[model samples]
Target: MNANVTAGEAPPRAGRREWIGLVVLALPTLLLSLDISVLNLALPHLSAALGATSTEQLWIVDIYGFMIAGFLLTWGTLGDRIGRRKLLLIGAACFGAASVAAAYASSPEMLIAARALLGVSGATLMPSLLALISNMFKDPKQQGLAIGVWMSCFMGGMAIGPVVGGALLGSFWWGSVFLIGLPVMLPLLILGPVLLPEYKAPEAGRLDLLSALLSLATLLPVVYSVKTIAAEGVGAKAIVALLAGIAFGVAFVVRQRRLEHPLLDLGLFRNRALRAALGVALLASATMGGITLLVSIYLQQVAGLSPLAAGLWLVPSFVLAIIGNMAAPGLAARINPAFVIAGGLLVTTVGLLLLTQANSPGGIPVLVAGYAIAFAGTSPLGVLSTQLVVGSAPPEKAGAASALSETNGELGIAFGVAVLGSLSTAVYQSRMTDAVPSGVPGTAAEGARDSLPAAADAATSVPADLGTQLLDAARDAFAGSLHVVAVVAAVAMVLYAILAVVLLREVAPAGGAEPDAEAGPDSRAGVQEDAAARR
Candidate 1:
């Protein structure tokens, strides 16, 4: 019973212990999501307090996500070898400790280091939580419900993170935002062993150190290269880093194919349904991440809203996203999942197109309406695509499938923030050069051109007329950048929509109708099992 291994039929309906344990799992899930967005409101405060440059600020905001994405596969596999609860408890402790360090960080470098540690620790939590949920609620309906609750908590946390952080920042220093993790984590560390069952794969293999290193090497360098290209344009350093990442990535794939017990099962990609689902998930995550950062800046700097007010403006979109998540399963059951996904993407395209028109301070309402539509539209992708990916894999490989899904999500968000943020930064800088008023001091002019926030700071040092000119130019430059990113993101959604229609067209409708005969044997069996479980 403690091992959570069931022989044939779905395990007995989850009892009281399983339900309580779910509450415990939600604790870390909430904290992890909050970490992703809490800093959006706190960024300006921290930047001012620590004198962080724009690049340093991006690193601070996104490095945690990058680290999490890099380490997820390693930790997910490791949990199978060791035990899920054990890993969760250990990670909770580490998360708590790292949060304290981040809270008291003396400089941007220190905060970034602490966040990286937080990311590594955070990686251990998700796979364990997800695998445990599947184990704890083996009945398909119960499992689905448990997952919905878990996702709701995560979505709610992300939605409310800014508001919560804004409240904290209003009353305390920026560091107070990090301390929110402490209260949630401490209780999990204490109650985890009592409430949560421990599960390890009976036939799990030894941890592959080299594959782990290769994954990290491949991911980090490529991400670095993308960020660099955006920051400094195409240069020797960017090219070398990109090439190194690609080479390492090739090696990682080759090694996975060769290994008896690979960290990742390269075979999973053969299932076209899973492949397309993950691709859609990654791009969607990236789009959402980039929008979150840009909108946060626009709310505070361009529209000149207070942090609390800005956070409030964001609440409706996230709430609607949670609604969309809740509705995706039923929608999929009613129609082919491909069309549902394509429809959602189309709605997202509409949202992005609306954002393209948001080029002035008066566009606040436009941004809000577009963001809500975009969030709600993309919500189905999160739930439905994850189901497709996991349902496309063999039961034994579910953990790996789940790991891949989670990794793509984390990495996509990081990529969005870095690449899109950099692109916007590039555009903003280019525009500011020709836009700043004459007679501004050199340092002040250079500062204004650096970023929107810097422009706000520089404006105070000059005469009102010149300062207004500088601020207006910065706002216009950023709005134009937003327009460009929106168009690009909308185009991406359209392409992915077409891809879903083509690639996922054969997938069984949600309530688990059997896949068409054209599906690979593995996918067919997986879908059959998923359907049986639901029944």
Candidate 2:
């Protein structure tokens, strides 16, 4: 059967092509994740090559996220109208092309432009991949295994990014890391056409060009506003940007619900399990995001560790996270995921609380231990919460549900950076004011302060006495920020724990989606068919 379709109709059954399609779909995820963290290691080379200022450097680091966050929903909807396989193949090509450009980017602006483009291309994969996975593994147990493997790979690349980057930096130029994605992407592009199934939307609806435009109008500004608040804090312009984002967002929502086939189905919020899953993803991310950033900073600034050393030392936590994530489903299958979530939160909260007591005059070991506990807490969160989210939705709405899951994570990161990250910057700047050399102007002092941890060693304009004073103050400010942020995150998690306990009362117990779990549904379907046979 030559199974293609008109604009929006039910896709032909994706028999035989299912497994291949899922693997092909996961390719873009690893490619972009690698590119993102690889740049962190490449920044020194980029700095020397581009002669970029600190603010310019911040732009380089941030613009990719801004692009990724804004376009996620846009591309997700685009796939449902067009063929998912077609877009997946197209996005892979774009990602490879972006890498080649980024590798040889002569200027900072050029590099940033390349990354933004990469973000646009990368957006195509999120919906297509989830939808493809849902179609491929309609049986819940198989789907659980598939999602676990996909998620493991996703986190694997993220966790290994720093380590891989360190190695690549030693052997290859900054651009070399970009070239690395090319080799990785080639097979996915080639195999994609042959192996992946094409998904056609079940309903025929206009692509709704106006709603698409409106989405960009609202999301881009809100995401950008959050990033701005992260870097610059809440001022008049930031306040205006935020308000503008909110107003547009409201209009966008109103427009969506009125549409025939909306870009995203907001009605999915009605599912208690789905809602709880997303809430946990967001809260957990806010806590984890804040802790991760603060720990990296603490290692470099307070403990005098190099980025490579700090990243290497942080390996234990990430490694433990892998085990924790892998073990969670099996555990959640046995015990209630809610209490498991609570236990994880309590452990993580204890870890964060341990950091407040870490303002000792001693050293870094205690801080590292605190981070390990915090990171360990995150492992279960990535798995159990996702199980609840993906497991909550019906077959057709998986992509939309998965998109919301991701949206929560992104929101977590944004809020973590805005609220907690800002607190850190403010405390660091205010407390460390006298730490700067009196000889340096206020503008320069402020500039130097804002770039802390990343450029701690290079904050060279201060006098020796002031240098020691500033360094100590910088550490204290960061610790204070860490203390405050951790408390905020911990409180949010604890509340989520209570919510999970109350809301997820009768969740599919452990292995609910496992092969064994699906037997009940299968048996029910068989009974109905047999009754029909008798009739």
Candidate 3:
């Protein structure tokens, strides 16, 4: 550890007030996650009400995520210059205002704009909350527990979002889904200043506008290109966009290396623990994201479940995810976190294998079982890996570090949906094309080959007997595609597990003491010094 720190001794424990503040901080996480899932369920209703074209519908959903991914680094580093609490409060206000605007939006363009604003505001919340947790809970064990609780809330939001959307859509309009954020944000904004402590980097300098622009340029094109490749397939435009993003990314890194006060510290990645933890987090998220997309499509399109029924079916997995997040810290307290992460990945691989058994419409139960096991296994990895990523960074750099972690998560989800989802779709289309009846009209046949949803729509325009044959063939082909994707996902999980074991072999448990002082102050002295100051 740095010469300024003490080792072996535990850091200060959070007081009752600090614990309560954690709950306050979690409100934004809950709302942000809820927004992501709820909108998917509301898409049908919103599409009809706003008279949205298919392209506009895609934009409405895609813009929010794209904006969030692009702005995370900017907001995270900005929080370090201006206090985390201050940035969080501002974000809360903007998020709440955007929600109201979204609820009342009358046109597709307006709704898309409102969702983009929500994404911009949301970028300010996640990193700030995570960094705050690091500052509040100084002890290694308590910090693990705190991060677990924070992650649990995020998972809980995802679990309940569909159910909440189902209920709202049943009774009111689709806009009511946006209203949910208002209640959550109201309390956070009211009590945040009264209860939450403020922290900022003491020696932080002026914000680098060029670096911020470069970061956005680097991330947005890559994400957009992946999305384009998924929807439209690989082409010259997508290839160029990808190359441009890589070029900008390289330039950003080089600029950071030369800057005295960089937006993201290049030195942080030098730590073996931090580097490995980030990699694990990214891969785990990608797997979970892909699995979620596949399951949602399978349940609704293949099994013919209504939105409400599908959401209800997903409840068990969500509950198990929460359980896994809560249990990870205690398990890691006894065993090394590396083993815990590796074991979780192994369990997830088994779950993926179980999904391969879902070969028919009646296999809904099998899908549910597989998803629950996979979600439970993967949830703990998220909590523990996130803890490792944040905890390994110096206290002053917590916001930037946390931002990097969250950015990786967004990218992982994007890649999962783009790559894995695309792979499944490609298989589905090829199989679907073969399954289409010989006498079907060209338009109907083309529509059926696009997707299950398109096939369902196309079925309505055809003769009753032909429609039945078409639907059956489409569902069967989709099921085959699902099986293929499951196998691919399982193989990916195995690789991730091996990587976790190899990379984190020497990483200690979350409950273990800090790194030894003899290792030198540059490694962990900043964290120990901050804890000492708080005490």
lDDT of 3 at 285: 87
Scored by lDDT, the top model is: 3
Global lDDT of model 2 = 0.68
lDDT string, candidate 3, 139-201, tens digits: 777887888889889878988888888889889998999999999999999999988989998
In terms of TM-score, how similar is model 1 to the real structure?
Answer: 0.86
Q: What value does the lDDT take at residue 399 in candidate 2?
A: 56
Candidate 2 TM-score, C-alpha based: 0.85
- Residues 1-535 of candidate 2 have per-residue lDDT tens digits of 0001111222333445676666666666676677766777788888887898888898788777777677777776666667667777788889889889988999888988998888787777665676667556544445555666666667667677888888888887778878878877898888987887676555637677777777777777777777788777787877787788788888889988897788777765655666666777787787678678777877877777777787777777766666777766666756777777777777888777777666733547777777778777766667767656655544444555566666678778887777777777777666565666566556656665775652255345556666565566666767776777767767776786787678665565543432122224422333233234324
Evaluated with TM-score, which candidate comes out highest? 3
Off by over 4 Å in 3: 1-6, 513-528, 531-535
Off by over 4 Å in 1: 1-17, 40-60, 104-112, 138-142, 170-175, 418-462, 513-535
List the global CA lDDT of all models. 0.80, 0.68, 0.86
Better of 1 and 2 by TM-score: 1
- With candidate 3 superimposed using the best TM-score fit, by how many Å does residue 24's alpha carbon deviate from the native? 0.9
lDDT of 1: 0.80
